[model samples]
Target chain A: MSLAATAATATAAAERGFLSPTGVEITFVLVGLVTLGAAMVTVTTRQLVHAALWLVMALGGLAVEYLLLTAEFIAWVQVLIYIGSVVVLLLFGLMLTKAPIGRSPDADSGNRPVALAVALAAAAALVWVVVDAFRTTWIGLDGPAQGSTEVSGRFLFRNWVLPFEALSVLLLAALVGAIALSRKNGGAAKNGGAAKVDRTAKVDSAADEDSGTPGASGKEQR
Target chain B: MHLAYPAVLAALLFCTGLYGVLARRNAILVLMSVELMLNAVNLNLVAFDVWIRDTLHAGQALTLFVIAIAAAEIGIGLAIVLMVYRNRGSSDVDRLRDTAERAEPDAPAAEKAEVIA
Candidate 1:
């Protein structure tokens, strides 16, 4: 009787629905909720850096969805790029800008009501379409072989070469443009007497001065 | 488990991201919101890819490229933001409206001051 009980227990463990398909479904719901909430706050947050941080949460949730689908490569890429680099760049921009660190009216003004309505309408339409298109469709396990790193690499280098090359060129152009823009802005601010850039720099510089050396300007905290 | 699970998650995420993009006034936050939207798109791609077995990773492969482009975009975007902060002072994207009206070469000196001040 004990042997039978033990066998039953083992079988139950193996069949634990939480570890099965049902588990994946529950996780999907929970992650979606969290991602949605974070994405909302990412835009609503008053602080620039705080918004960027919330974006990280939203991006991470997407990664989780990728993992649930067995797209391991895409999952990792999501983490490495969106969370790792994209957000960091956003923060860097926030830091460099002269926007009020505490509370700036300029950071919180827009036609929010209209925007919200439009966004909601668009989302509702998209959901309706997607749901209609695949209402009763079921996933077929035997459809395609799961992607391995090797196969992914081969496909990228082989069939998607044009797009890949185009992306690279786009990035290069953007890089050069960003550099030129930055330099030009720096010069323009000096020559044209812009207060926007200087205001942010002043606050940062003031903070720097208070901490250690006084009367120094534009020397950022290390 | 229903395939609708991941789809719902992606939709929710995308909606929230859209709200952020529309509501947030901070430039950095706007960029972050854009990232959020992109991630939501990625989620949809992966989920659909999973549901469609015949395609065999096409969706996921596209997602990888999206991630790569997102990374590069962030890099250059950050550099631009940093520069903007240096010249304009604050990162409030709303203040950028005036500059957008005036072409780059013809942007007024007072407009720059208004942003930094």
Candidate 2:
């Protein structure tokens, strides 16, 4: 259906020009702006947990972009996998790392100016190239929904079966790793500090002793 | 929808992630930046899938695969970060510089760095 629509646009180019913005285009741009802003905040926030929360907004905005494009299955999957699990897992990681509850002054490294310059340069090049290349191309969302469950599952099982199986194997490997983590946790529950110190002795510098504890090594470097 | 919208958005988002990866101090925040980059690519994939209308739906399928790999990667990455924190008692990416090129021609520092690793 989208194929037909693209073909139709060849003759109907005048019907949908860039000057005449569609509702979907307007919504996409607005959401894209919000997503971009949230992403900016996620990277810039001083508080560690706030970065994770803002990441949720950025990711959710992308999910909305998926819905606007009429890729229903991908949209739902974005919600389920990204928002439901990834962000929560990130929060858990922050907690496990004992991130500062209040704003940590040294959230960003000293190379922030360099990072900003590089990011801006890259964004400029990419946006310019994309807009110049695809100025006339159009995506048709009016067709029978493309990314429905039936379509995704069928294509996945048929054409993408091998990669799908390999992915499952990878998940199995992750599960095993998770189990190892739990067992390690249980063992470390007792004398965890001792185990950590023993490891730290090998990994950290001997001079680190003159410094504060190893936990403060991060700040010491800062 | 104009194809450029998603394409342009993906490009901008990817760059934002690049900045995050470069500027963030904590390893976990770096990982978050990596997630942003991955999500931008996923958005691009879904958009192209809708636009091209391929018979096999390769774009969406690939997006799913990317998501799974990202999950596994984050798990392993966190494990490594946690291990670093346990040994060094910090997750700062800038600190654990045991193997950095020695400025001085001192043999003892090099030897110590070698032993620590």
Name the candidate that leads on DockQ: 2
Off by over 4 Å in 2: A1-15, A181-222, B106-117
lDDT of 2 by residue, A55-119 (tens): 99999999999889887888888889888988888898899879999999999988999999999
Runs in model 1 deviating more than 4 A are A1-21, A98-106, A140-145, A188-222, B54-56, B99-117
Clashing residue pairs in all predictions, respectively, total 21, 0
TM-score of 1: 0.73
State the lDDT at B35 in candidate 1. Answer: 77
lDDT of 1 at A183: 61
Query: What lDDT score is found at residue A82 in candidate 1?
Result: 75
In the order shown, the candidates' DockQ scores are 0.42, 0.52
Error of 2 at A5 (Å): 7.1
- Expressed as tens digits, the lDDT of each residue in A92-189 for candidate 1 is 67765644576554555567887789788978987887766544444433334455567677777877888889988888887787777666444444
